[model samples]
Target: MQPDNSQPKTKPKIASSTTDPVDFDHAIGPDTSTPDGRREIRRATAASAMGNMTEWFDYGVYAVAVTYISFHFFPTEGGTLMALGTFALSFLVRPIGGLVWGPLGDKLGRKHVLALTIVMMSLSTFLIGVLPTFEQVGILAPVLLVLLRMVQGFSTGGEYGGAATFMAEYAPDKKRGFLGSFLEFGTLGGFALGTAVMLLLQVGLGDEAMMAWGWRVPFMLALPMGLIGWYLRNKLEDTPVFQELEERGEVQQHSSLASLIRGYWRPMLVMSGLVIALNVVNYTLLSYMPTYLEGQLELDPQASLMVILIGEVAMMAVIPFAGSLSDKVGRKPLWIGSLVGLFVLALPLFWLMGRSFPLAILGFAILGLLYIPQLATITATFPAMFPSHVRFAGFAVTYNVATAIFGGTAAIVNEGVIDASGFLLFPAVYMMAACLIGLLATRYMPETAGASLRGTAVPDAHDTGILADADA
Candidate 1:
């Protein structure tokens, strides 16, 4: 059947609220005044940003600290390949962790999932700091290290989805995108902090001390931050959309794989695609760039991470503007624009940056700034796709699947390509490809920025039952 061109699309009758649906002036909580409205958005959004920064700190420390750990973990001079290889392999476990806990977030609550991940991450990180080295514990030491790394990867996989979902849900209808982007802000902020901490350690410690003890400090110190995040996540109220679903008996009682497949499968596919570019860029810029700078340019590891920190600071500033722009214009174009820009410039930007420190920082700042559009939009994008009942789970699983495939493998693929082909440009090409996929996907997905958080159950003009129910 050819798509209909004759019948004009009729929009639904929306209930009128005083505030503009596209711009959140005063739409959330009991606060209608500007001060109160901004306060609510800030307070709720802070949790996501806070949690994200802390967790990324954990992961970033791993990457930056790899230099310190190679000797201790592998101890054999000829086995650097084997050491980094094993460390990289732990990333594959991220998808499983995401797949396992993501659904629970959908069925249970974002806050619950967020809190759980904080605890798991904190415990694992602290234990990793204290784990016996291969020198003392024999072969089992590295094996245990891999196991703990898996736990950390798993926790990280859940962390973003829950935090993003929570922020999106709490954001007022007009400012959902702006609010949701804070999740990434938190994430990148954490990334910066981790790099900065490692930088500080390097400045103060000798090479021997760094390899011995300074490497452990970053992970061990996370205990207090994780506890603080857990408290904030637990104390926060659930999103208004999720609350409405619960009151209406709309929440799915079980998070069974079959149940999610039965109901939210379409969203699973759409969201996975919708959020992939950001996930790809997110990892490419945040995680892979570190090794790229340190390995390729032969820059000081400390200086390289510090340069990246400046880029992250730019990222933090750009996120809110992009998100707020989405509120004013819409989510789709902003997202597509970012992807398209990346497709066009990723190769040059990455290539130039890899050549010089000053140029590298400049390249990163530009890439990170343009990439902010995805960070701003996707936080609100996924939640808007599903009904409150299944929004949490649907968003979490799909987001994780995309991240696992594209995001988790970013560093691995970039490094592998660089290693195998002796071409340093693959990371840029890889980023471009992911963005192109996202550009196409964003074109067909429905617009939901101003749509009600509770889904409309009426089917589209076509007589598909599930689409009809989603509309209702």
Candidate 2:
């Protein structure tokens, strides 16, 4: 059924303490309708996006440098699989991190939790650069890498949910889609920066040097990038919606997980379904593409990197426009279009990719652009699924759980299935399956574009007037 967007006659009643009532309007941050308010919103966007960029830079570097990682850390036989497995291993602990940090962000505030998570993520990423190789430490080398990856995963569990919530709450109701896209802009920026850095080093230092130590340089840069993100985040205040919750004593003081499962299970399940598609496509295109191109398709390492780099840049360029478009036309339509498009084209594009070098770039670029609608609207769509109180935990727990199951393991799953069946189109088939799941979820997803996120009530398209038509 299409969402009913008519506004209700009265505001929903929020549970609040009578003795300590706070003015809701006053609790919200600077007036976003004003120029000064808009400036502050932009700053908040940058701070949130920077932390995200810092986090993904690590993943990007790790993904592109998997060959070196396998060589240095694992045995000759099944080394690539081991590296991919380690990559998946980090995701195993993300749910635990979410369980711990998500509720804390609800109780403690988004900024505090985000600050701590970024530091942990960056430090662990930096430490990977300094870890001893298998030749140096025998069995302990891979062990250390695995441990740090877990730390990165644990920290990331909190980082993304908090950042998205932070960006969403700070943005004006009308412009949330446009502003939120910048956070993902930072996402592709990080991946592009990391890929570009790795490529440059591979070219300048030669393959021998890159294998020896050049890969470490990209990991090391994560520290300073993290520090800058920390600085930017520290300069800002918590989201206005969160502040309003705090002022009214609505912030969850105890375990939010139990409450989340009991009260908001429907949205949690829906979000999880959406995430399955989102991250499968996400990890496949951004994280696993280089490996698939190089290992499965028999493309050269440099050529694979070039393909990924070009595709990512193209996606980055289109992301903001897609995000802005979501505001006018609504998020569900863009998502539906994207899922359907990818489902239809995944096979053809993957086939085209095998034809030649230029075709590979063209195929990847087309797939990436098809993916932009979903990628661009992530921050705008997911956080609005729950109210301010459980938004962090709701998003963190479900997203991490689904991501751990399907996303983090995407590379290994694709590689294993193809290795077993000798089916070259397995990845495309896998992505098509995920897109089907996403389409089902998107059908039921509430349209929240231009909807106010100020209250504890779940934002719904039915509760507010339609901002625009499908053609708008």
Which lDDT values do the candidates have, in the order given? 0.72, 0.88
Candidate 1 overall lDDT versus native: 0.72
Tens digit of lDDT per residue, candidate 1, span 264-308? 677677777766777778877887777778876688887788888
Each candidate structure's TM-score, on Cα atoms with residue i matched to residue i, is 0.86, 0.95
Which candidate leads the pack in lDDT?
2
Models, CA RMSD each: 6.6, 2.8
Model 2 segments more than 4 A misplaced: 1-27, 466-472
Clashing pairs in 2: 5-464, 5-465
Clashes of each: 12, 2
Lowest summed lDDT window (length 10), candidate 1 = 458-467
Q: What is the C-alpha local distance difference test score of candidate 2? A: 0.88
